[model samples]
Target: MSTFIDIHALQTLPPSNINRDDTGAPKTATFGGVPRQRVSSQAWKSSIRQDFSESLDSSQLGLRTKRVAEKVVKQIEQLSEGYDKEKALSEVAAAFKTVGISLAEPKKKKNEEEDSTLESGYLLLLSNQQINRLAQAIVEANGEKLKKADVAKILDTQHSADIALFGRMLADAPDFNVDASCQVAHALGVHESEPEFDYYTAVDDVVKEAEESGAGMIGTVEMMSSTLYRYANINLNGLVKNLDDSEAAVAVAVQFIKSFITAMPTGKQNSFANRTLPEAVVVSLRDDRPVSYVNAFETPVKESAEHGRRYEAAKALAAEAQELSETYGMEPVKSYVLAVGDLKTALEGLGEETNLKVLLESLSTDLSKVLAN
Candidate 1:
């Protein structure tokens, strides 16, 4: 039986282009024959990963970049004072070759300063522990070439929290792929939404009264305000297996819940400052399967005379979950809710209401017990 943790949030954002398309407009999708603002899963996942960097230890995180060899080279230099940049680059490149990852040849600039940094063909997601261990292996080798099996073994295990949660796919070496234990649904607005344009001009600060009569620059930016439905889930069994530690998996889950609720996409943040917390959050632990209440907004929530979109959306979500539970007997082993304002009243009976801190603490205890079983 696969244990799962499902997290749902109803958040409201002010006029902002949190995620944009090639045209620089806010992302949108048509659901129920109505256009609704959207924020891609990739965007939210990126925000969550960045949030991880702030709260989690650097050693328990991974780096995803094409400059894997360069990072390893730095690690090698740190591990052994005897190894210089040139020597470290050679050793790191040789170690990568053993794992079938050929680093790009160093390119020399016009200045004739040979760039020693080697890049991989694509971005490689490697945990900090893996980099440290690989560097230690090179230092221990003392100019001797590392074996293929040794390098592969070092890369295969010791996954960091982010890597384990989001997983990795190495195109050049599929054997090193880690299946992601978590899935995030692209957040969609709960009601029909249309893009609004902000047309404005900027004056040149250096321009004197007679120097420039017109504005230095003028442009239009597309923005949208929406109450969105967000959903994500984690396969606890898979997470535990990826981490190889039940307690650590629980800790990751707690952090993920917090991040999912609070982490906001920073697109045009300076322009809009559209950061907002979730109006309501519902978390459930299940032994059967994870359930998403996204269908609640399929009909598109409409604001009432006395209440706004956030309150209406919360009501709809609660009603949807209740209907599904009554009809299908889809009940979770444990559940919690954190809501504010009239949303607290609108989401009655969804679960036990709690604050963010208490919700995480209780979730940690419950998850440990569930995993123990």
Candidate 2:
């Protein structure tokens, strides 16, 4: 129910600049010989879940929870009037301050307090299998009673598992304990508005003639949509809390959410060459590869598109196809591989075979047929 985190932003974050060298502090590393700032697999996981929870309309968590709890304290303070209830609520509010969890806040207006984050994303820290494991732990903790789990699952939930553990957590923990954890899960089944995001590519309009007038024809092009999804799972029981295991609910949720992110409101992304998109050339071997499109059909490529604009086209198509493969059950991916190959072939054919008239015409038709509106 939210936009995919931007990998560019994720890659550029300054390494944990904090002075502390503690376990929870941010981490840094040198990737490709460049000093890179990194959110630990842990930090990355937590950040995403936090963001996803908000966009999905699940609930505000962390310090926000404390503020809301403070609001409740304020009400209790009024009810307490002259009674010790004021002191008790005050003390509880302080506990909330210590843990940074609360039950209330200066009420946000309707459609207010979105959890959208700018400039960052997960870079394959937690694999899908790992995400599932984390959800399992959280479910065990909730056990029809997050209150009674007695910190067993809390201890069990690791930093690496942060994305699913916290995001789908529907109940806000009120009791204090050794874990020092705060933040509520999205209230069971609250329609967390889905996370929405997009990436697009546009083929350019290119001309071969240095014109007092135009030449034979302009370069052919097309547009496409790209998306990369990291971890996604929904615990329906967590949201519904109908069963002892809240985490299991999200299994269905994860699929449903993944579907929402892709294949809905399909359209072409307008990213174009240089003026709109300075192309990044990339080359990949495609020979003898079995690629499938939406699992409707599949085939292997005759050659790897490389060494030119075709290379770049191949790269883009490859990236999108691989990404879509994760969620759409393979057919979409196959379709992508075919289009990219077809495009690469077309581009490579330029300047040969009579200005590539045949190739260009074939490519234009192929691009049009395979890429649907």
Candidate 3:
């Protein structure tokens, strides 16, 4: 049976545009007949990936870009002494072609010759180990060339932690596709919210008081503030299978939990400085399946005169989760919680209350035992 790890958080952000639409306004979604501020899962996943680099080694991570050929070329040059840029590019192109990924022809610039940088048709996700192995293979080939089966095998296995968690889709090579072991939900506000605009101006610093009487520039930025409910889950079985290492899987899981809890989307952060920690967090280990408490606010939470939205939202979430678990007999095998203010009391029965440090330590220990089996 597959075990699932579900992470839920209730966070509050001040006036900020963490995720925006094409019109440069904060994203919003209508729920329960009311509009609520929204943050895309893509945005949060990116933040989580960025956070991974801080704690994990670069070798355990992957690179997603259209310049896979160029990266391979650089690696090839570094691995061999005699190979120049042109020779390395040729070898990289031939190697990718063997695996059914054709490098696009170099596009010429205006009044200049064609650029030699080779790129794939779309973004490719590759692990550092895979790149190194491929480069070594090319260097070892010594002009004999690599076989399709060999190149395909290298591309299919040895996935990095991020690739194992997020997965990858290769349209040109469907056989090499990797299904993601994790799912992230779009964060939604617990209560109705409306976009608010900030209108301001900047004065020309060089202009004197007599030279300029008015501001030099003026503009408005759309933003919103609200208490948001964020949720995500990871399939431990899938992650372990992708990584092919239980120990590494456990480490990745720990880092993922910490990143998800702390990483914030940095959209317009310089302007608003809206960085804040979650008011409450719940991590649940379930043998049956993952659960999301987002529907708990389907009716939309309301702030009380004494308690704010975060407190009210946490209370509602706890009540809803308890009722669901009891009614459906879906109680988790283990649950841990980190909360502040009145939220501690509100979510006491939800799980074992602890601090972030202790919670992560306990999680790593528990995950090891579970994955060991």
Candidate 4:
């Protein structure tokens, strides 16, 4: 039997530039003939990966960087004491070359910072355990010749949860690519919204009024306020396969569910301080394919006389999800809902009502049962 988890959330935010476009305005997309605030899938995935560090062990996380040689050199220096910097660099370069990465020097940046380290010219997404294993292998080789097989064996992404969930693609080596198990959609506002500009000037405190008649600096920032609908689905079977069927897979799933609830993107956060929590969350465990209820807001939810925007959005989401499940004949194995304020009653009839802690506990139990079978 196949099992999948689908999550739908409603989060309200005040005016903020949490995510921006190239034009320095809040990101947006047109849906149902109206412009809606958007936060890209890449942005939220990055936030989720960062949150994993706080919730899971370091061994389960991955590192993404173009400075593979530098990262491996540090490991070599730590593992093999007294190894000269030049020797370490040479050994790591040789190891990487064996894995199909070219050692050609890259173009200098505009600022041209003095960087002596060699790079692969592309992002190398590797796991912490894979890096440590490579370091151990390099140390054991004792400056002798290394083989391609040695690099391949150590570079295998065995215990990396981020790699398993978000996936990685090594351009130089097609064999190293991993298919992502968890799929996340871009978060979009439930209603049409417009970006507004804040224009202001700053005066230097040290500059005297007599010396400086004009302001020291002036700028405009674009921001928006809206209630967002965020959705994500996890393929439990694929997650199990990615982790090599380890028992710890259940814990990984649980940690991710928790992070999805707590993590928020930090774009101009210090300037805007748009910190907020999800007002509602509805999850479903189904043997059928994952379903997203975003289409419910295609017409754009509106604030009515009796209910506010968020409350109306929750009602629309609950109603749509129920209709879709019934229409598509999706017989969910289990379902749960956690909502606040008016959402508590709005989505109550959709599933078993519970809080975050209770929901997480119940989901963990479900994952364990799947592994046992």
Candidate 5:
């Protein structure tokens, strides 16, 4: 079943560039002298998903299987009234296995030692020999000769040697519910002032930095980058309750997430970033000679042509991405990629003597206020 969710819930206050210089003054920089907070798109995704259920993925028994197994067990118990529960269950499982349903003997947990008495909570525990005897009894009761192949198939698919299970859903497609759940409706703005930098991101080598820091900060722009681009994934399941069906799943999911977003002539674009251009530009700069980074509060750059090139390149990519999206498909993956290109280009061009500090101070502070809380 598909759930209809509003995309607005996904939006958030723009990220802030609230860090200070070594002297404890507010950080400053310029991209046309305007400061911009550099929040990555991913930080937003994680923070929001966090507000929801943590047990969402723990549906261990696969919903459909549990439901069907329940029905199957109840039906068999009545028929095998003369027999014990175990014997009755074995007989019915054989018949279902004879049909085309795919059933399986529940997998045993690796850590559990197999006892002759069987584990207390395991729903299915009949041994190979027991299953055969059960199957034989079932065939005799039905008054039909059962082909071994048919019996195996039915048992493997439908009569999952299982009883107690969880995570069953009434509806088939679970992903549609998740996709339809969230949307970032507002184009929030970022700001230049705050008590602290919402985050400090090291450029280029995120994994190295993560390893060095012991524990990485949560919901940082860099963290967003690391999650989607480097780790985790956004998957699309098919149109229906089809599982392990890649083609169907991809088509259903792609169409789903893409549909929630619409291009508009006049609508606000939300951003979680909040900083002045000079501040961001300063941080973007990678000075490898000393293997150290310049602070937004300490060094300013807007004069160097190299710095200009990097800023311009990043802008161009972002513009290109927007243009491409407007021109063609604004596939989420592609759009985000272009945005990242903008960020990487900007970061690479930072230099020691640039002069964007003034421009950042001058941009509309209202824009900054719009994104950050």
Candidate 6:
């Protein structure tokens, strides 16, 4: 298997807030002495993770939440006889103690209804299988009686595809932290871009024309339009090791690649229904270290000059990859390009041309063969 699987794509989004900052404007970053539209790595990765449910089975996924104690209690209540919520909470707390996690009382919120739900002090990254096994152990141990060895065995065998790819950091239990095998760069526009505001108002029909001439509500939202440059890298060895199954790891890699290439972040979708497919994608399988070609847009491609922003973005990316190989004497073992319309450039020369379905099949087969060797 190649040591790394790198994905680079170009997609154009119309005026929309696919990702927003604290002030509710579309995210922005300064590059080449100008502000450009930005979609954060967290936002894009979250979108990709959500898309996994559509393509992969529940068994291949992981759950991230602070209410782990509540989830575990539910499992325990189902499996163990004569265990109520209060008792289950105690049992799960004992299990957390084994793993060095504190089961704190659920923090009360002003707007939240009162309940007996409990949570871990921090978010727990856990797989379904791990949760079931831990619950079963608690039941077998008869609540608050699990031995250290039981906890050790449960934690050692915890395997999660999301946790493996995205990683988890435990501030209290650093030993349990998993290093992320997948790295995603923030998606940025291929051209210099700025935000524009959309002033809007809503009218109330209930009010009489004479009684209320003004609108019920008024607001302005910040948005932008541009072709984005997105990139990500996956470490095959690290993923397989984290998942503890080579075949499953390959399947996840394929699913993730397909999803990441196609998924759209759903921020302000109702207001701006701006979903779009990538204009072009370039996948590189390499044995050497990973490289990000985002710098290809440092000078920013211009729409008026390049005809369309996506076409020019594709051209710039292809040129950058070609130049990198020549300068560093590092050519990828294999490369694939998926493009739309007449936007094809020299990228076709650097790699084979394939559609998404064929690309997924070919990538899975190649990665599996490498794993076998």
State which candidate has the highest TM-score. 3
**Which regions of candidate 4 deviate over 4 angstroms?**
109-114, 206-214
TM-score of 6: 0.95
Off by over 4 Å in 2: 1-29, 34-88, 91-248, 251-373
Model 4: lDDT equals 0.86
List TM-score per model, in order: 0.95, 0.26, 0.97, 0.95, 0.24, 0.95
- Candidate 3 on 110-158: residue-level lDDT in tens? 8997677888888999999899999999889987789999899888888
Query: Candidate 1: what lDDT?
Result: 0.92
- In TM-score terms, candidate 3 sits at 0.97
Q: Write the per-residue lDDT of candidate 6 for residues 1-373, one digit (tens) a residue.
A: 3489999998999889989988998999998888999999999888898998677777677788988877888888788666878877887787778768777778787998888867777788887777888888878876448886777677656577788899988777677788888999999888888999999999877765557788888989999998889999999999998888998899888888988988889999998899889888889888998989988999989765536777777888988998999999988988989988867763569688999999999999999988898
Q: What lDDT tens digits, residue by residue, belong to model 4 across residues 299-332?
A: 9999999999999999999889889878888767
The sequence of per-residue lDDT tens digits that candidate 5 reaches over residues 176-224 is: 1212111232221222322333344444467565665433443322211
Pick the winner on TM-score between candidates 4 and 5.
Answer: 4
Instruction: Please give the distance, in angstroms, between residue 331's alpha carbon in candidate 4 and its true position after superposition.
Output: 2.4
What lDDT does each candidate get? 0.92, 0.28, 0.91, 0.86, 0.29, 0.85
Give the C-alpha lDDT of model 5.
0.29
The list of candidate 3 runs beyond 4 A from truth reads 106-113
TM-score of 4: 0.95
RMSD (Cα, Å) of model 1? 1.9
Instruction: In model 4, state the lDDT of residue 1.
Output: 73
User: In model 3, what lDDT does residue 68 have?
Assistant: 87
Candidate 1 on 1-373: residue-level lDDT in tens?
8899999999899999999999999999999889999999999999999999999998889999988888888888777776788888888888888878878865666789666678988888999999999999998999999999999999988899988999999887888999999999999999999999999999987784668678889999999999999999999999999999999999999999999998999999999999899989999998888899999999999999999889999999999999999999989888899999989999998899999999999999999988898
